[model samples]
Target: MWESKVNIYNVFELRSRTLCYFGVGAINKIKDIASALKKEGRKKIIVVTDEVVYKVTGAWDVIEPALKENGIEWVMYTGVQPNPTVEQIDEATKMGKEIGAEAVIGIGGGSPIDTAKGVAILLEYTDKNATELYEQTFIPERAKPVIAINTTHGTGTEVDRFAVASILTKEYKPALAYDCIYPVYAIDDPALMVSLPHNQTKFTSIDAVNHVTEAATTLAASPYSILLARETIRLISRYLPEALAHPDNLVARYYLLYASTIAGISFDNGLLHYTHALEHPLSAVKPELPHGLGLAMLLPAVVKHIYPAVPEVLADIYEPIVPGLKGIPGEAEKIASGIEKWLFNLGITEKLSDFGFTKNDIPKLVELATTTPSLDLLLSLAPVKATKEVIREIYEDSLNPMS
Candidate 1:
């Protein structure tokens, strides 16, 4: 739990509504969960997923049999693309409406889970569309129950009260955080993640890295967040390479999955700052840019700038990954360089230029970062002031690969 805002009495709130089950064979509980839903009159569910992930992970094998035994049916919507768009949400919402799907089951990573969150909102507010939902024409208080069966060790959308989707026409990506959107149940069965490809395994875990780093240092940070954030980085630093090397290593997958989940929880309580605020616009403009990769490119630059304000927390969080890194004043550049070199070693060597961004693109990126609907809230949480010039410099600093 976390306080909604900083107060004078060192007060904070730590409330998580979702009941999450983490371990191997965790997916086996789907039958019992589905049976309960059926008894509650939610006989049909809307399953949102991408084409490749649901099939590749074989999660459907468990889900299908369980639902059939319980006489529960599902309508599958597999149209979610990376950086999931409003159009995709609308399409899935339409499918869910057609079946009157009472519950939402998101079976992949962030993209599908995000779609499910949108579908749940639109399903409840039949008159509202994706654009209106993003615009907050009506702040949502409730939606159909969502069950997130995670297939990747990233985004933690399953366990957190956050969802993001883009408006293709506007190139606007907005984050949704409401109590109603937290999934009713979350299953983090690392068993499904073992078949994940090497690059995704790297990228997704890096997403978790970005999560804990921001959560531990954001202005809203609390001791609860800091403790879990430290452990998250420690686990990722130790287990990510092993998971990358032995894709079938269940133990490695289990720890990495655990790290991602806790990272999600850390940010859920602590909130986030600059990296996420800026990365959304990058991926929104270029749909093919993966969210984790975008965050990876911006993380070091953000660290360099924000370190002066919260050096101690940043140093401790990053020490496992970048040993001997310190929190000294004016050491921002050295720390930034160290972080860039570390990410470079982790295979995220591409500059913004590699993604077709340039000095000319910086202005547009800044405009989007500042003016987009929900981004300002995140920028406000930065330990350092996230002025336009600072945003510009961070983008500029990321343009060339670290030497």
Candidate 2:
């Protein structure tokens, strides 16, 4: 009898740079972490964070004591802004250089972590400014080591090798993903997250869900990414409400942190699509609007537009949240509506109008979104191809979701 032959041809890869520590007192391990990484003789470091985080959480109180004990001299750069701008990056970089900093430790949410990554890049490519750096006109061969301490369970900037910075002169917020930009290590302490304002908690949780939803439905999604995304969705769906209802609940906070980390990893591997594309322009144009809030407002509209293209993936995404909803007629709309309701229950019922956006702003938003170079790639990965007209329609729908 002749033997049978079989051949398989599927290839995929997942990459993560940060070694993550998660738990109640993970923040206390900063001393040991700094000691281990300091073997390279880089003792002087800069802690990048925002003034609000530094003051409100007293993250510096926890981090500075550890660094002092470890004999790791440090300076502070608390100039990071929400949706960090290139000017902030330049300012922080200049401070880091002035202090003779060797490593950059980010101690806040995405903005500070991203600022640290930008500072790291600029530290190496000393000749480049933020504009040149973001324009990809001067790419550094390597960045100074970055250690991220996450205070928010959003952005996943802690574990991923991507940094989003706004170039205000150009009115663009570009996401820079380079191997060197990844944090050397990440500390995610749920205790740090417990004090988050209720609104911040709600927005960040929704942001994590958006990450998983976009990643799971994108063309780049693999079986591995799907599995992670599924678990992330389930975890956020179950625990976010609990965390909100009982702010002191450590278990809920831990699961929310886990969900954020897993979602970050999944989307870092699979990438995101229209929801991110739409939200970026919203924030770039109106710098005060939080990224997660924009995503929450636009997600349902974007999902409805894309449902015709990736109904199966969308159905699977919602199935974990709304058990037994898949395989039913009009399930996609139901899922989208359910998500909107869930967000509403969490007190995130604001529309674009609440953020100073009107129908008159739609065209400009559509223009900004469509012209974004990265958005072309994101839209390409989206299950549904979004033209400027379609993007405009999504923006219009987002302005009045109930209509």
Kindly report which residue stretches of model 1 are placed more than 4 angstroms away from their true locations once superposed.
1-8
Write down the lDDT of every candidate, Cα atoms only: 0.89, 0.82
User: lDDT per residue, candidate 2, 300-343, as tens digits?
Assistant: 88877777666666667666565665443366577678777777
Stretches off by above 4 angstroms in model 2 are 1-10, 327-330
TM-score of 2: 0.94
The TM-score values for the models, in the order shown, are 0.97, 0.94
Compose the digit string of candidate 1's lDDT tens values, residues 271-337.
Answer: 9888999999999899999898998888888888888877777778888877776566577877788
What range of 10 consecutive residues in model 1 has the weakest lDDT sum? 1-10
Q: Pick out the ten consecutive residues of candidate 2 with the lowest summed lDDT.
A: 1-10
Best by TM-score: 1
